[model samples]
Target: MSTTALPDIRAARDERVVGALALALAASLVVQNAAVAWAAAPSYAAPMTEVLAFHAEHRGAVAIAVGLEALNLPLLLGFLAGLRGLVEQRGGAGAVWSRLALAAGAVLSAAFGLYAVLWIGTVLVADGLTGPTPLLELVWQLHAAAFAFVLSALGTTLVAAALTTHAGRLTAPWQRWLGLVGGGLMLAAGAASLPIADGSSLLFVGMPGYAAWLVWLLATGVRLVRRAA
Candidate 1:
């Protein structure tokens, strides 16, 4: 290969790697959600007795979910770093947005870490108790709050990433619009975090937003991989 052709080869390799990272991140998220669903953990509004019983009886399931959540944090960071590199290399506009995405993704990962830790703590404490305790309830509530914060951070990351890619002409208009709408809903839900942690119905608003984000990740990953090929 000519020396001049080296850059193209390297760029293609970068795209493939980044695309794989995105796909891996998306898959981790899917598996985490499935584990959570399988656990069937009680809602924040559940009675303390019920919450305590569920945690104690289903410790293994919840533990699996927490483990998957822990795995997701690094995957998320890796995806964010790779995506930011791609945006910067494309070198058109939205560099600021790319930076915002990285910042928000960092926050998201931190929130996820805290959330996982809280869940683990809940399971441990609940298992050792015969009945519901104030401390256990508090920990569970904090976990809910942490999850709300994660949604907020995730919304910001999605919006910034969508804008960055769109500005660089790397994604379609529909993806941008979806991100804007979905992110807006997530932000709205997160803004009501206090109420949500107290068991407000507002938490449901972020569900569709989260789903939209997953779709965006899958589509973006496929697009990048195909382009590289």
Candidate 2:
């Protein structure tokens, strides 16, 4: 094979690997959400007694969800890193945005890890106790606050990644718009973290935004894989 052919082969491999990472990240997210939904976890606003009871009764389900989340964090980081590489390889025009995406994704992953730990801690404490304790409630509230931060970080990552990919001509215009809208909503909700942690319903605004991000991820992954093929 000619020397020039090696670069082409490497580029194709990178595309496929990045595409697979995106797909896997999206799938992991879907599984995490499904597990959470199956767990029927209570909202932050639920009464302490009810929250404790739910945790006590659904420890296994909650554990499963947290475990899936732990798996998700690394997938998210891998996808972000791969995405940055893709953008850089495409002439590095969007290097700034790619760097921002990677940084935000790192923070998002860390925040999510904290949230998962807090959640599991609450479950463990609740499981051993017959009633809700002040400490358990405090831990749960901290978990909610961590999730609020995660939303903001996710918003940053989505917007930056969208911009980077679009600037690199790696994604469609519609996908960029979707990311902007979704990221905007998530930022809005996350800006009200204090209220959200206090059990405000305003957090609902971020839910659809998160869904949009997921759709964008899945679409982008498919597009990359097809192009590589």
Candidate 3:
């Protein structure tokens, strides 16, 4: 197949898998978020505590968190592949933005993965496997950096996808709207990550935006697949 045709082929195959990956990722995200959200509950103690508090308290949930978190690696790879597939086949402003956005997402995903690992390390330390360390604090700093870049990617991709269409027209107002809303949410989320050191409660405010971005990403993937088809 020609180079241009290759992405379409990949996109065709990816269309069969991206939705499934999205579902799995979303499920994992919900579980992960639930754990975080639960710990943030007013009834819960350890207001000054980090995520280690939650993992240590709910051991079962910790297993769930770790399991769900582990699944993200493959899902993220698949997402990046799908984005690449779109770009290789389409090769337009939309595709370029999508690639950058996916790159940002990948960075944030990696940072989150590192954060989970740090949490696990803290657990190990509490279990007497290691010494006390500032792993969690380091994870938070990485989180801030990852979120900043991810926000930029989100905004660029959303706008690019909104303005360009397969038909080569500046149509698809809904796509544009998704871009604006999703982009806005990411920026808000990035801002929220900054003040997180002051209090964990502020993280709660960022959740809705991330949640919206997830929804928008799923929708955008589906739209890309349909357009390619």
Q: Is candidate 2 or candidate 3 better by TM-score?
A: 2
State the lDDT at 36 in candidate 1: 68
What lDDT does candidate 3 reach at residue 98? 56
2 against 3, candidate with superior lDDT: 2
Q: Candidate 1 or 2, higher lDDT?
A: 2
For model 1, the local distance difference test gives 0.85
Model 3 per-residue lDDT tens digits across residues 78-155? 765565554555445456555565666666566666666655554554442222246644543454445444454545
Identify the runs in model 1 with alpha carbons over 4 angstroms from their true place.
none
TM-score of 1: 0.95
- Give the Å error, residue 48, model 1: 1.7
Off by over 4 Å in 2: none
State the TM-score for model 2: 0.96
Per-residue lDDT over 58-103 for candidate 2, one digit per residue giving the tens place of the 0 to 100 score: 8888878888887888888888898888876778978999999999
As a whole number from 0 to 100, the lDDT of residue 139 in candidate 1 is 92
- For model 1, how does the per-residue alpha-carbon lDDT over 1-229 read when each residue is reduced to its tens digit? 8998987787777788877877888998888788767878788888889899898788878877878777777777887788778776777488889899999999998888888899888888888788888899899889889889988999999999899888877678899999898898899899998988888788899999999899998888888788889
What is the Cα-based lDDT of residue 90 in candidate 1? 75
Cα error, candidate 2, residue 123 (Å): 0.7
Worst 10 contiguous positions by lDDT, candidate 1: 83-92
